[model samples]
Structures are given as C-alpha cells and as structure tokens.
Target: MRYRTQAVAYPYWVVALLLYGLQMVFGLLAIVKYLGPDPIRAVLPFDVSKAIHTNLLIVWVLTGFMGAAYWLVPEESRTELYSPRLAYWQLGLFTAAGVTAVVGYLFRWTAGNKLLEQPYPVKLAIVVVMLMFLYNVGMTIWRARRLTTTEGVLVAGLAGAAVLYLPALLEFDNYTVSIFYRWWTVHLWVEGVWEMIQGGLLAYLLIRLSGADREVMEKWLYVIVGLTFISGILGTAHHYFWIGVPAYWLPIGGIFSALEPLAFLAMAVYAYAATRRSGLAHPNRMAVHWTIGSVIYSAFGAGILGLAHTWPSVNRWTHGTMITAMHGHMAFFGAYVMIVLAVVTYAAPILFGRPHEEHETAIGLWAFWLQIAGMFGMTMAFATAGISQTYLERIIGLGYLETQQKIQVHFLMLLATGILFAAGVALYIYDFFFLVPRGHREPTPWPAAEPVEA
Candidate 1:
C-alpha cells in the first residue's frame, strides 16, 4: 500500500466479502423456494430468507462503499486518513447493528416493512455509524484541504443517502401514507442520489484505468450529476402511480422516469469514450473490462429494462409481479453491485499488492463471464414467467394460484439458472479471498540524499 493508514480499509473490505458470500447463500435459498417441495420451508421460510438476502446485500454494498471512501479519500487528497481508529470504530458499530438486525429478522422481530424492516433501534445505530463515518472522512479532507470533485460527489451522495433514511425510521398508521413515504427513501435512492455515488466512483475508476484526463472527466461528472437530478427527482412519481396518489402522477411519472435512463446512458458513453482514447495502454485488462462492463450493463439493466415497463400502462400489468423482479435483479446487479465489484477489482492489487504473473487472471475472467451469463439467463427466465403470469392472471382473469401453477415450469428454469449464478459467485469469492496475491512489488527507493555543491 502507498500509505500505511490505507490499511484501515482492509478489514472493511474483508467484511464486505464475507457478507457478500453470506448474501449469496441466502439468495440461493430464497430462489430455490420457488422450485420446491422445499424441505426446510418451515425452518427457513421464503420471506425470512429473502429478507436476509436483500438486507445482506444492502449492508455489504454500503460496507464496500465505506471501504472505497476510506481508500479513495486519502489518495485523492494526497494525505493519510485523519483517524484510522475512528474508521475501525465506525465499521464495528455498523456491523454490530447489522448483525443484530439480521438475527432479529429470523425471529420475526422486524418492523414488517419491505427493505426497511430494521427496527427503530437498529435504524438509530445506523445513523450513529453513518455520522462517525462522515465525521472521519469529512475531517480527513478538511485537514488536507485538497478535496477533489470525485471525492466531493461521493461524500455528498453518502450524506444524502443518510438523510433520506431518516424518513424510514418513523412509523405511519395509514398504508397509503407509508407507501408514499417509502418511495421517498427507496426510489429516490436508486434513481437519484446513489447515482451520484456511482458516477463519482465510475469517474475515479475510469480516470485511473483509462489514463483519462482528470479535468475532462470531472467536467463530465457535472453533466451526469445535473442529468441525474433533473430526471431522478420527479421520477419518484413512477412509484406514485398505484400508491393512492392523484391521477396527475401518471403522466409525470412516465415522462420523468423515462428521462432517468439518460444518465445511465451518459455513463456508458463516458466510460467507453475514455477507454477508447487510452488506446488500450493499461496493462490490467480485467480492470478495464470491469469498468466498461459496469457502464454498459448498468445502461441495459437500469436504463433499458427499467424503461421497458416504466410507463403506467405497462407497469399496471407488471406491478408486484416477477417482471419487477427481473428489472430489479439486472438493474441492481449491473448498476450498484458491479460498480462496487469494479472498484474492488481495480483496488485488489493495491489492497493485496503482489508481483503475480498477471494481476487479472483467467480464473477471475471466468468468474466474471459466468456471472454475466447466468444473470442474463435468470433475467430471461423471469421475463418468460412474468409474461405468462400477466397473460394468465391479469389479462385472462385467472386466479393468482392457478397462474402460479401454470408457471411452475418457469420457476424450474429459474432454479437452474440460479445455480449457475451461485457457481459464479462461489468462484469469485474463492478467486478473491483464497487466491492470495504474492507480488508486493513496492517501488524502489530513491538514492540517499546528497549535499549540493557550492
């Protein structure tokens, strides 16, 4: 590592990987429920398993984001972190709360809100940890007085996400009121502020891997942030379609949410243009692949698939169906998850710096391709199932259970593809954690200082 204090990120990264593996475990279990005769349905119900899967995913990614911030801030500012101890403390506090919340969910001790099930106490703890984290990062930048645009956007996104979560902490007696507020935190995040976080990291990764000019890239950052806010804020109306809101939201949601994809499209173009300008000079082809892949996949998943059913007409048929699940899997995986993994892949050499034969190995490539292929297959399976269900249940007016029975075959296919996805995840975890990098090729030291001749 270039700086000793960068070691603070190591533990956070380790925690992210561990949580990632656990998340996959629960994810497989949750999906397998669709294909069963589930023997353990009583012991581990689908709801609990799915909750754990989703909750773990959120925790792990946020954990990855925290580690990325710790790693990036110091490097960007050209200063060591202000307090490694505070960073560690923040991680511990966050982990303790997360673990407790996960355990509580298994025992039916949740707030019963989808994706916001963490009890009030757990929510408070999250806030505390977030404060500590922001404090450490904010102070580090202030101490150095060398904040870069990349880091500034990232911190703003992090703080905005924290502020958005505040609404979820309170309870509402009315379902309409609750659902209305829920989207404020949920939709506004994926479509709004989190995009800033992604854009910032994307800029950082592209600049380093593509040898892109910092001034030019940050200029692109301003454009992206502008586009995200322009479209994303009003796009919250998309969720307002069926949430007991007025009919006026229908057109507003369709119009604005449709524009939301422009930001993702811009990201893809930005990454590709930057890389092409590099003339493939960077040695680490794997990092380049990840960087470019994140951009394109996010565009397809978040922009294209999201728009597929975003309109009120299409959303009416697809709402609360597997179609949403399909968009969700691809959108979340391609957009947020891949970018986090991209950062890890790019930083792995630094984190576990080793003079290996190739920093980007064939096994790593296999893992990446396998995941992409498997997720595509899964998405197709869901699409087919959702289409059939919509026709049978929604259009044809068949009963919900009857439609489900007719679509069991699709669940079988889902299970099959899910196995492939699981395998890819397993390989990635093994390649990253098990296969140690031995090339700690530190830069050579300069010769001893010599006295200047008079």
Candidate 2:
C-alpha cells in the first residue's frame, strides 16, 4: 500500500469476497434444483435461484473490478485517492443497491430482464453509484496528471461499461427490439468493454509481477484493446442472428466473432512473453500463477469455446442451451474473475502487512487448484449435457422436459463439480478473512523493482 488511501480498497475487497461466497451458495442451490425432487420448489424455485445465482456473480465480479481499480489507480497515478470518503460511500450505496435487488428478487420484484433484472429504482441506484466512482477516480487522475496507459485503459473500460448500461434501462414494446438492445448491454459488456478491463489488469499484473518492461506491456495493451474493439464490438451481431434481425448479420457476426479469439490469444502471448523476457521472478508466485492462468484459460474458454458456438450455424442450435452455460462459466471465471483474484493475491501481502514471500500460503495454493479442477469438471459436465440436449430436443424432436430428464445424469455431474467449486470458493473466503491479518502487525514497505526492458 504505497498510499494511505489505498486502504479504502480493503473493505471493497471484503464485500466482494463475501458476495462471491454467497454466489457459490446460490449456484449450488441452482444445481440442486436442476437435479432434484423439488423439496423447496414452492419457496425457492429454480428460476429465482438461477436468477439470484447469476446476479450475485455479476455483482461480486464488478465489486472485485472496482476494488482492483481502486487499488491499481492510485499506484499508477502515484498519488493518494482523490477522496477516500467518496469511495467508501460509493461502496456502501452500491452494496445496498445490490443487496436490495437480491432481496427484492426473492419476492419477485424485478423487471424480468435476464441480467438487467433489477427494478428501475435499483438500476438508478447503480447508475448513481457508478457516477460517484468515476468522478472520484477521474478526479484523482486529474489531480495527479500521471495517467499511465494501463490505468487509462482501465478507467476507459469502466466508463464505457457505465455508459453501455444505460441501454438496459430502456424498455421496448417489441420483444425483438428489446432483445436486440439487451445484447447491447450484455454482449458488449462481457465481450467488449470488459475485455478492455481484463487487458488493463493483465498488463498491470504482468509488468509488476514479472518485472516486465512497462513500454512493452503498454504496447501489448494497445494491441489487446485494438483486437477487442475490432472483433468484440462487431461480434455483437452474433447475438442478433436469431433475434429476428436482418439476415446480413449472419455472415457479419460469424466473421467478426471468429476474429474475437485474437484478443485473448494476444493476452496469452503478452503474459508469456512478458514473463520470459523479464526472467526475474516475483516472490508472489501465486499471483503469477493466477495472472498467467487467466490468459490461458480465457484463450480456451472465452476465445475457443465462444467461437465454437458463436457461428450462426452452431449458435442456431446452441443458444440458450447448457452450452451457453458451459462457455459462460469458464469464460467469466478466466477473464474477469481470475484477473480480479490476481490483483487481490498480489496485494494481499501489502494490504495485510505480511512479507511478500508469505503470499504463497498453502491455503491459497489449495484454493487456486481446487477452483481450476472444479470449473474444469463443471465445463465438461455442461458441454456433455448441452450436446445431448441439442441432439435429443433440437434434432431428435423431444420435448424440453423429456430432454432434461434424459440429461439428469449430467446434472448429477454438475452437482458434484459445483460442490467442488463451492468448496474452493469457501477456502478462498476463509483465507482472505480469517488467515490474513486484519491489520498491519509491522511496517512492511514492498520493495519496488526496477523495470526490466524486454
């Protein structure tokens, strides 16, 4: 923690981690609902459970992203946060909004949009929170006048996410129009601006953890951003394919979506090249592991798996199936979730005032590998179930319920793997809150490394 104001990020991380644990709980409940005899169907139905599960995921990951930015921006700008009080207020209000939205969902108070299910008031609250956040961050950069490309890209991504969310606030009378614009928020987010966020965080991690050249890493950031816009922005057409859009979108979406992998591939190459070129190891090996793991997993999950289904021909069958879940689980984890964890793990020692060498705790390693194994198993389960569903229902002409019944075995696999994933999440939460020191025991200034030119 170079600046005293950086301490503000601690509470943000705490909230994010707690919400992450809660998300896993809801996810497990969702899987059980899929596999079961309906013991609590009247009280906690599958739709509500699934909605809570997905909403919690988005909330926690965004919380993590904000926390990471709060941590990163000050360091990059070489100044204290412009307003710690404002940051805390933003966290509190944002959290309240999220919690209120979740509670409301239990009672079925929602707008019924898939990801944008939050009611109008909650959406307004979220917009207000984002405004507060951007104002504080933007002011900090202006005061310091030292915005690095890394933080610049990060802030831009965050701003774009806020702007893009405005479309979700609008309601359309036409279902096709509603669905079309909904993708403007959903697809553009995870695939577009969120990729920029991932790239920014990835560049920061690679440079710091590997002692990689700032110039080289920043250059890679440009390439990643360029690739993301070139592929991701246009890739929005892919979701429009079956949404009663014009037929021209079919070829346009396929071509651009296919090119989407180039961004993730560039990130993978960026991390690898940074590590190899620097050849200087940071003591925080677990952070390095996560940093590297993010790019590799995303390449396969977000890039490869996404491409596998985004084609008009394939997605015509796979959309809204378990296959989407398959890609979503791994892609979100790899691209957004892992990068956030990378920053958390990297900052843990400084935040807790522990020696940097202490970062590779036994519990941390277990948490990392368990999550990897669990998510891998979950993806496999979803893939098999989706394939079977597509064939049994889409091709073999079975009813949806009949198809699901046939795929019960895969649901069993999902439950088992989901439990493992939940366990990993539990370990991570425990390590963060219990094992880590509540406050600094001793003065521990992390030694700054000289940048190694690549």
Relative to the true structure, how large is the alpha-carbon lDDT of every model? Answer: 0.84, 0.89
Residue 192 of model 1 has an lDDT of: 83
Give candidate 2's error at residue 282 in angstroms: 0.8
The sequence of per-residue lDDT tens digits that candidate 2 reaches over residues 54-77 is: 888888889889988999899899
**Residue 147 error for model 1, in Å?**
1.1
Distance from true location, Cα of 274 in model 2, Å: 0.5
Worst 10 residues of 2 by lDDT: 445-454
RMSD to true structure for each model, in Å: 4.0, 1.5
Distance (Å) between predicted and true CA of 430, model 1? 1.1
Shift in Å, residue 378, candidate 2: 0.2
Residue 332: error of model 1 in Å? Answer: 0.8
Badly placed stretches (over 4 Å) of model 1 are 355-357, 437-454
